[model samples]
Target chain A: MPSNDKLFAYNLGEIVPLSEARLHISDLSVQRGYGVFDFVKVQQGIPLFLDDYLDRFYQSAQLMHLEVPLSREELKQVIADLTERNQLPEAGMKIILTGGYSEDGFTPMNPNLLISQLPLTLPSDEKVAKGIPIMTHDYVREVPEVKTINYSMGIRLLQEQKAVGAEEVLYAKNGIVSEFPRCNFFLVTHDNTVVTPAKNILKGITRKNVLLLAGRRYKTEVRDIRLEEVLQAKECFLTSTTKRVLPIVRVDDVLISDGLPGEVSLQLLQDLKDLEEAQMTSPKV
Target chain B: MPSNDKLFAYNLGEIVPLSEARLHISDLSVQRGYGVFDFVKVQQGIPLFLDDYLDRFYQSAQLMHLEVPLSREELKQVIADLTERNQLPEAGMKIILTGGYSEDGFTPMNPNLLISQLPLTLPSDEKVAKGIPIMTHDYVREVPEVKTINYSMGIRLLQEQKAVGAEEVLYAKNGIVSEFPRCNFFLVTHDNTVVTPAKNILKGITRKNVLLLAGRRYKTEVRDIRLEEVLQAKECFLTSTTKRVLPIVRVDDVLISDGLPGEVSLQLLQDLKDLEEAQMTSPKV
Candidate 1:
């Protein structure tokens, strides 16, 4: 028998079941793909780093010229209420802000917020331990920083990435590998310095946290990262909401160093976990 | 009393009501805006230039690496059936090919094709006589030729365009005004040479017909079109499926010569309408 766990969807101002949550076909979100979204992880019934997620979400909305229908505090309350209703100690919440339904398309009108929760799908321990291979694709996102619903270039090469036995696709512009489709990447120099591209990439929350934590003890530098430096580096890793400090063993179909998970990546992964655990154990927000 | 009229939505292989067509929230088309679409103008219950529309639609899908689930003949048959079922003497049909829903959102799967018909909204003679004003935005579409669901850049400037009292947004790369967001732009030189940007613009079916008709009577050149040339040209116009030929009287807060519709634009509009009338009178394809 299947479990009777009901998933909740916060559509506009109403909380409905996931199946009942639907936007009209005339909505700009569906018609012209005008929308912005952000994902936040929940732990032990507490929404984690929701403020940061909302910050990015609102930032994306501003960049896309979409107005958030609800106030920031109201949105926060909605997420908290949804988390309480769902009662999932460990899950992920995705908040979407879309351009509202309109007969005259391409004009900004009222905005609709659709919030949904899903079971977290983090990178497995084994996958993280052995590290994964990534292929390089020469393409740049239209708006590198704003997390819009435009991913045509990134996802169009999915089959090719799978064909190469690659777990992710890394994007490069003019021989500079900046970021993957959904994550931020970093490098560990031969001399033990940690480096990541400072621009032309979305500033991932996990990446920001890792940088803050690592700056306390390690030589951390956020600057321009060329493809040559990535290939010549001792080790490299990637960071995102679901996948934290995922070591990259190979890039561009070539093994990095000895084709093993780097020491810095392992240490940073543990560091991030400890930080997350502390945040989870702290008083509920 | 309300008249009973049922609007049909072709969702993949199923023909359902327009309201009944719903793609999953996790579908790549919704999540990542991975899709391509084309619009066809129907006249007197006949689907006009559907072959040309489908060719461009397929070309866009191919450019985006999206595979249409149905073959050309099958899709054509479905379109014909849908048109016949609707029985609208004059209408506009929009066909959308989306990246299917998946457990993993990025990869392209079995495509979902959606076809919807809407009452035609064409350019009026009075409005054409007092030609439209357009504003130039300094941005280029990521894929200028492909009709992908990436209109964020175009739509984000909606407010700015409205502030300037502009009807549409024309995109420019550097100083070359390539095309409008939804139409192909053209200019007629002082020497009566009709010129349009050969590349970096969607090859609209109407544009092709206009070019063919004009090339026979006038010296027509399809080449690079600069903003300076557009401002200096004797006449300016744009073409699309719904709007056959629209004369552009003003651009970038500057009034064109005499601030009125040009002779070439008027002639081309009539010529294009004659061609359409011939096509309509010809045997149904």
Candidate 2:
């Protein structure tokens, strides 16, 4: 069992044992939906793409009228300390800031800061090689800019898709393809142009990197990708902090071009892998 | 500060310090809004209407596809022990059940159970006597059947309303009266008939009791009351577990019948008080 033996969390101001990082039942973050968070992967003792992820986190907090309790530099130091305390070279770090303890059920005064890491074992080479299936759901991510704690719709939709053996749930509104509940969706049009939903989806760090890398290496276009067009795309894929560029060979029982990873998706996945490898092995800064 | 200093909470079958009753940061309850809860008031060292609250809690858990980690009897015992440990003669008790920690962030196992209490000072007679003015916001409660943690709309609307100098926010969807973000909305028509919106409102415990009490006393009517009609109602009121029955003398700057508590609202409030006073003070077996 990969347990907290190797897990250390930054609670409030200090890096502490994971067991000590607890939330009082009175916290509005728990009683009400008043918290924001971000997850970044670590490799070779370095937080991958920290700057971009932090920017998104701050954007989300601003939308919620929550001030980041710590300065960006202070937060960065804490992340570094958290990594040092956990003694991990490769893991996934989640930074959660909750509108902390409040006797007033709806009004929160204290803000909680919790940073923890978990072991990461990316999918086997074969799983990524064959690509994965996705199911569509009709649910809009509220405060999509901020990684808010209230993710009931996303979680339930994911569970329903997983129950039917799908890898993800592609959420849509008004028959237009939004993005996966947790990942960003992209498609390669027949004209060899790569397409993705507009910024309405989570401005995922990995999604941004994938787009930049793909544009640098191949022809691409980011726009309002409709569901009907997505169903007929030459290739479909998803991007996330953890799953960098995963191919979506099937969307709901519809075979995405003979149920195989599209040529463009495979190339983009390789490009993202190359980018990650360069960053992970980049000289210490 | 009115703290429940003696309040003990049950954390995984062990009685722990009230302050130490905590859940892991990754608990789905906090990570995702995949948790359900119940809040009930304790009066004179006894949990008031606990059975009814617990029944609703279980129903909420089931609706969220979560299993209450304890048997009904076990939960009751935990509640009893929790109340005893807290030594709270009168306080607010809440039970939170989250589909516990998970690696995949989707599938959860070993749901976490948290119980805590805090001294709640009910509004003074002076405040209730003056009644509360409210503003209407276009919003609707999600998963009205289950007390899920995804209450951002409810909490945010209330906060926004408060910013505008309103004590509460009444939500309406498509001109139909929904509910107050935190409480249930009720009105007394000009004909001495009590009425409230039937659908899309939390079947609040206090609302149920008030309805029953009104039916027994004033022939209350339960129907879909539109927002316009509610705003123009001769008398308006709100109900919640803690508030019991509070008069809404004003809505959106409009005085509800000369900005005074309506005759029917006043009658129902008295009826609710009598019922609360009639409840047995002794702990039930």
Candidate 3:
């Protein structure tokens, strides 16, 4: 699908064309792959869980030593203005913080921030219902706790995942499943416990919300979920801003829950949607 | 000081302006930090050790699964064309290979290759005479063998290094000195043995030449050199395409041999200069 032609996007405090929102070639984001970013879902022109996202965004920036060019209130105001100017009821707001260009190519001088909103491409009902298949690979991310723009291993494994008829690849190191390429991996144990890796993975906002929802309804264990447990899991799912509690029906051609989406995964997804619905019905921020 | 104004740079097989050399936002190099690059020094319009640099560039590309869009011969011709067009007698050539933009913004589709030539800024005489001071940081890059663009940790420590009046940071993990942020580090032991890390480095082209020079004249050991050994070494230095064999008279607060450039490191620098002189005086490619 083609991207929506927006009249303006938040580019270094000024609204510019989405097509023309470009950074210098010397920025660390382009030169050294040093950057941090966060995504939030905007519904009915209201950004859902803005505080959670901005908090995590700040954490990510601090981890990478990228100073956000704007203060918290200023950043929020920029996002609100972008949401208003774009006039999109539903979209994905991506906030990127990069170490700005330096005189010497390798040094960090200043920080640059850019905000862009992309029209949401809702997942197809058929694919959502059938769930997505993912392949597993033995890999792990550096500084796995931060939402940095270093996805080299994940992108390299794209072809191998496609060849296996999978949509994503789950990363496992030493038989311990850590994360999916770009999302948080969760598994429902045979005893009806929700387990996800607590280390060497990004603490995704969606994963946090799902954990909160799961805690009230079922037993939740946040620890290292090994590949062996994943293989024997009654159900599997991934969580991200774009994919909230997406079901995983198969792994490495092994049918998960008889190749069906489990009830718990669907229920948690409904929980997130309910939260989003409440925010959408409320007044805009 | 400033980049040379080249009429065209090789951009995905098409020649484009140096200022217009831009990649799509969805390219993995920008979005995912999945890319590899190598730099070759050109003096007097001569590309020094072009073959060795390209071989390492291809190795780095293969390690990251980034396919170069052009063959070695084609790439050489493009670099030659870029050099001639730029008309820079002394410069640096940066070859970049990236997984191209994806339709879904998460997978590799096509590959993009670009060659850029930048005007060389000669280092100050004071910096050369006094040598450079560096601080040791306990961090290691992912896939340290490949020259990928993931320098998140190094960039994060730029401020600390600057605060200490250091030119760079030497990466050490568990007291084992592996490499500098962008160069291979070497130390001259008390017994006059040349030592460098055998693993977790890019195997610099300059390092290769210096190693050859040291092997013929001194006792050389290509193995893990600890930080303690570095503090106690008679002298220390770094090797890279741009910096060549630069002496390190001080690391953090500890001064090497009373903060004087040792004879071994100076000799190695002279050896690299001699090799470059030979290359430049030879027939231009």
Candidate 4:
């Protein structure tokens, strides 16, 4: 067993070693891939945006019709317990609620919940500054607003994406740009306005915070973004739990205005870090 | 433990009790819902259409980039061993191959193979004669050709479908009829021509056999089917491993023709049974 196997996880109602966190083969998560998940970043023993993540997690479960077995306060307590047990200040907490084991493989039954905390390493300053390349695929996710455990298309395209040195795949449909596989996309227009696709996206907590920060200094527009507009944008960036605010230097082979991370994206990243620092240092409610 | 917990299943490479067959939460199937599966019907100790089912299973795994750890012959042996151990004459065998345990939770690692045999009870004669009602939903499956474990949309709509007395949901996108949640849709025109959707379908083994049998007596067309045409269809039915050639009498609020099992569908169902009987009686290939 690996050393990380010693790490603890919340399985069903019991806290067990990560290695022992197992699910039956009949689970819809295994049988029909029917489940929803949410990730929360743990910074210095603090689960960042816990309320927001929990709200989205419960909403996702509701959309998928998999009732979360725990109440809001109970779930928060579980997360708090897991955080203390794992003893990892800098980590990611993955909460999964699956359509439980069904007598027949097709029906949704009592839900099974599993929560695990794992080491999370954010992008280095140099890498974030240099930015990453992403490839666009003409596809749209189903039930885009809900963060379900359905990432087959993105995971399947990993090989093809890696072949071109792209770190992510941006989903687009009918020439309209959407979100990336795991992150939300943002564009800085030539007029310095912030634009991001409004529909068909799993609105990320980081993206929400970034939008809040960007709103303070720039005119932010949430609407459909065209691929052509993206190509002509002054800057591009993605926001996620782990990728707080990473710049995107290139989309496919086209450079995002001068083939470098733009000033606006860099400024947003710094602002996001400042916001995080404030949240981490502020007194709890 | 449940009484069925005593049943055996093949997990990874070991044959274990079904209750003991579990996967780690880190598996892509659990974390990302990345996997493919195929079901085969077994009768009288023989797996019907084993070759065709195996071919499709491998094809699904290939399309999902999940390498089936066992070769064709090895898989056949595993199925045979499972059949012998389970000692059930009438059953459904599920073959699942998943993007295995990944370190990053997004990457596809070494695949996991799970084979399990479960008791299968086909629809009663009265149920088949009366036919089942299905609701039409404005949706299309992602990667419809591959038999992936992604059935979130279908399963989530179960309650709504049941609320309207629908046994299944027929997915139609932009007025184009594709397929049912877990079966293939077919129609018989007023002129006696048999038609089934050619694109965006799983192409079930039972559908293939029924099409072959129908072709022997009727003009068969494999092409796009529209919702407008289905309402005018002389007969409507579905084909699946367990369903065989079950008729569809009522589609939403509209009934197909006289709202009774059409002669053409009943004839095809009989033909399919005849074929199955012959296969069960024939010597091993």
Best by TM-score: 4
Q: What is the C-alpha DockQ of each candidate?
A: 0.45, 0.46, 0.46, 0.69
Docking class of 3: acceptable
Alpha carbon deviation, residue B75, candidate 3 (Å): 3.2
- Candidate 2: tens digits of C-alpha lDDT, residues B1-285: 115455577776688877666666667766765777889888876777778888899998887778888899999888877777677667888787887876555566677787777777777777677888888876566566668777666655555776878898888878889787668988988887889888987678888888888888676778898877876788888998888888888888788888877677777878877777677444352
How well does candidate 4 score on lDDT at residue A207? 90
TM-score of each: 0.93, 0.92, 0.90, 0.99
TM-score, chain B, model 1, is 0.95
Which candidate model has the greater TM-score, 2 or 4? Answer: 4
Q: lDDT per residue, candidate 3, B208-277, as tens digits? A: 9999999988999999888988998899999988888888998989998879788898888888788888
Off by over 4 Å in 4: A1-3, A283-285, B1-3, B283-285
Q: What value does the lDDT take at residue B102 in candidate 4?
A: 85
Task: Assess the local accuracy of residue B167 in candidate 2 as a C-alpha lDDT between 0 and 100.
Answer: 91
Give the higher-TM-score candidate: 1 or 2: 1
Q: In terms of DockQ, which candidate is stronger, 1 or 4? A: 4
Of the two candidates 1 and 3, the one with more favorable lDDT, higher being better, is: 1
lDDT of 1 by residue, A44-72 (tens): 77777777888999999998888898889
lDDT (CA) per prediction: 0.83, 0.78, 0.82, 0.92
Lowest summed-lDDT stretch of 10 residues in model 1 chain B?
B1-10
Worst 10 residues of 2 chain B by lDDT: B1-10
Q: After superposition, how far is residue B145 of candidate 3 from its true place, in Å?
A: 2.6
